[model samples]
Target chain A: MSQNNLTSVVVGNRASISKPRLGLARKRAIIRFLFILPTLIFLAAMFVFPIIYNMIMSLENYTTISIATGNAPFVGLQNYIQLFQMPLMSQATWNTLEFVIGSILFQVIIGMAMALFFKRDFPFSTFLRTLILLPWLLPLIVTGTIFKWIFDQSHGVLNYILMQLHIIHAPIGWLISPNMALISVIITNIWVGIPFDMVLFHSGLQQIPDELYEASSLDGANRWQQFIHVTIPLLRPVLAIVLMLALIYTLKVFDIIQVMTGGGPANTSQILSTWSYTLSFQDMSFGQGAAVGNIMIVISLFFSYFYLRFTKES
Target chain B: MPRQGLRRSHLTIIGALIVCVMLFPVYWTVTSSLETNTQIFATHPYLITPQFDWQTYRIALQTQLPHLVSSLIIATGTTVLCVLVATPAAYAISHLQFKKVTWLIVALLISQMIPSVSLDNALFIIFNKIGLLNNYFGLMLTDCTFSIPFNILILRAFMQSIPKDILEAAYVDGAGDLRTFIQIILPVSKSVLITAGLFAFLFAWGDFLFSVTMITQNSFQPITVSIYGYISQYSQSWNQMMASAVLASIPAAVLLILSQRYITAGMTSGSVKG
Candidate 1:
């Protein structure tokens, strides 16, 4: 039955077939194109068109007033220049880098620890591992809200626990103090991010053959030595992918900071994404907002180039 | 091996402790929702609800029910539409020989890194010009910007595993390309379809940036926007706010519980394949 079907399919593809069959072949190609057309149209309209429009909008003097009047005059590089001049822009840039680096470092470290710890099979290890993914799976707004309450100044669980342990003399303003607000959001972000790293590294660890570890042990290697020699070397690809992805994702983070601190304590926690939002919606400077947004895109593009490079290399 | 058994039990206990610490925030959200104003502000916090309390939930539901329904509509609409557009595209990408398909896949991968704010900025203008603003259909369509490419990537990965011979068999039986996809491929790709649809639903349901940007009306606001709104309005009412947070999380939590396997498979495969 299979041989018969294969022969028929092969014959159907022959160019030497009848003219009528040639028509059928053309029709099949058209049908295949039709299958992909809707997706193409959607992407063109939503993704491609908007990105081009965004670049155009960034060069114009667009604002809420201009939007209403429908006359956004072209001002080449003016918006970009203004973006540099804005005081909050530099602060936001620094905060964005800090947020990304701080969150990624701790998330990777803690996630690696958790992954290595849970590498050993034990009763209910799988169940516990799944439970830890709760933070990552929850909506960002939900995570933000939960953390907002957890870091509440007076009645927060963090401060309460610290006070109970006699670790602090007074309630620390986790989200209220300017010096601490960015740190607070980063902590929340790290908590949300750890599970992603953990799961990815967990799977990566599972892929390394057990024999490598056994051999290392047989060679008089301690557990730490085995991990350094056998595990780290083998996990490099997964590690690079995880770091790049975490960077890209963290750089675009908005909801967590927006909800937790509103980039608050006087813009100390403000990042690029939220700053772009404030520029467009709150400040009514749509052109500058688009420029700020374009800046973010450039930064993301830099990271994405590396991401694609790493994924391709791996 | 005998001594290792003792260490394994010790590791399990330690793992349990770690999980407890990590999930404490989730637990606190639930308990805080049940606490009274006095209990919430007490110098010492109650680790558990002192008594059974549902007032916060009652109030939350009374105000936020419409928003939840709005979320359900948008999420479901986005999921259905995303799967519809992406499934056939995924099939074509996997089975058809198109020179440009590789470039298209690269574009799709690049789209994942584009910030939602940038999209929202341009979309706000375009949607306004086209009069799609404040429309559920419009919002649902925009939500697909995130989910459709993701669905295509995942579904294409799954579809590539479907043996070419089976498709050829269908073709030899005089089934058209669409027919082969519908009749032969769709049935086999059921699990992936579910995974893709579930992710689309979750993405749309949890969306905040698009919701705030596109829908300016209170009536059209999804639960995320409503919850954010509730925070500012009822900033003093922590219990009610926590109640709303818990309410907003129920769908995701329920899906996680019921579809743990699919979620894990989807997350792991989606990352690895990308």
Candidate 2:
């Protein structure tokens, strides 16, 4: 349904407004405007104001000390230049790409597999599908806490299981060893992301007719061929939506990382979100934090353009 | 037919197994919370809680009760405010012709793209000046930034499908706009309202970014921030730490069970509208 398309026609609703009297319609319109006024003011105050304020803050040399002094003088681009100069900036950029891409890759693949498997309507399939959503529904802090212990260097459940399975001789430092820190967080994200992708994918899959599968098989298409040809092509719209939404979700993923590692061990696992937080809160450097935050906004806006476009087209 | 039936049963077994593995961590959270310190810190932590213990949970509850109450207040306040503000707007935009609808929609989408960290940064500055630091009202306002837009959209979607004749009949009955909304639209739209309210409550309840950014004082933190502290302070007491995490997740679990369909429907309609 194009109902999801916000810019779609409002023919039915618009009709009600068509034939009201000039004076009464004016009155009605004013009332309706009044209805939306609360939301308008709220958005302007909470959202638009903060965005502009963040931009202004990014240009200044604001810090905690400035809080007491009341002296956050504007230093144009100084914060951005400082951001670029930091060695952590480049590492975080690379880490964000790896984390987002890695998490999306596995989440989609594994999620797609689960969605396909669950398409075979069996007993308790619906309940099972819903049950799998616990990970997605749980508080991020809980997930992070659980995974931290599971990924502990010594005496961790994951390591114990690996050794028991003879998969490895020694316990792997999943959250330690800066090299694997990002990967560990990515793994935790994938686990959390799978159910979301699966639910959406399954919804998309349900829209495809069983007749198409039957027809494809009758035309000598094998199961693998049907999936590659019929299923994949039909799922393009969903694929685009899922990928974009996942991108947004991954970009906003500050809680789990903050809870799990706090971008620790010399900031090895710091992505832009966590790094912005560290600069703003922990180090009390508001300018650098807002600068990092603005960079992420730029990135989000770029992808959001394409995302809204795809949503419009579909 | 017999072979197909056999395989279907086998698939059931496999599905159950997949669930077991997928949910092991959640299972571990509960079991670990119940286990003693010795049981948890072992080379191989027990997969099951053999000896039940409520002491850790008691200790966690003692420490985290205020935070829980704070989370409840914020979440409930967000739900109340989001519905109160967003409903009238959603009803107006969906039922009436507003030229500003498109702009509002864009703002909603763009607001979603603006990272919470930036809002946290800016809000921190504003809150510092306004003395809203560690304030429930400020935190509720910030949390509703996400909730209000989604509530408006989801509620509007449902309101749009509500057959105009139902509203037109109310208009014919000499009922005013406010009266019509209160009498007819509100009654018929109960499910959507509940769904939206639940989503709002959960979003605020589980919120960490805003809670952590806005509220610095440990005593006034939400259960989320409290549990984050619980992790560090009780690092040795894994039971209490994990128990606190479990305590924090109660709202999510309860709501998920109580309103699974509404939860999923809200989720999809908020994004990929059906």
Q: In TM-score terms, which candidate is top?
A: 1
Q: Where does model 1 exceed 4 Å of error? A: A1-20, B1-6
Question: Could you give the C-alpha RMSD of every candidate to the true structure, in order shown?
Answer: 3.0, 2.7
Off by over 4 Å in 2: A1-22, B1-6
- Pick the DockQ winner: 1
lDDT of each: 0.88, 0.86
Q: DockQ of every model listed?
A: 0.63, 0.58
Q: In model 2, what lDDT does residue A303 have?
A: 91
CAPRI band for model 2: medium
Q: Model 1: per-residue lDDT, tens digit, B1-274?
A: 2124357788899999999999999999999999888888888889988985888789889999999999999999999999999999998888776668878888888888889898889899989888999999999998998899888989988887787778766765778778888888999999999999989999999999899889999999999999898887777789988998999888888888888778877777776677
The interface root mean square deviation of candidate 2 comes to 2.7
What is candidate 1's lDDT per residue for A215-306, written digit by digit as tens?
Answer: 77778888888878999999999999899889989988999988888888899999999989888888888888898888888998899898
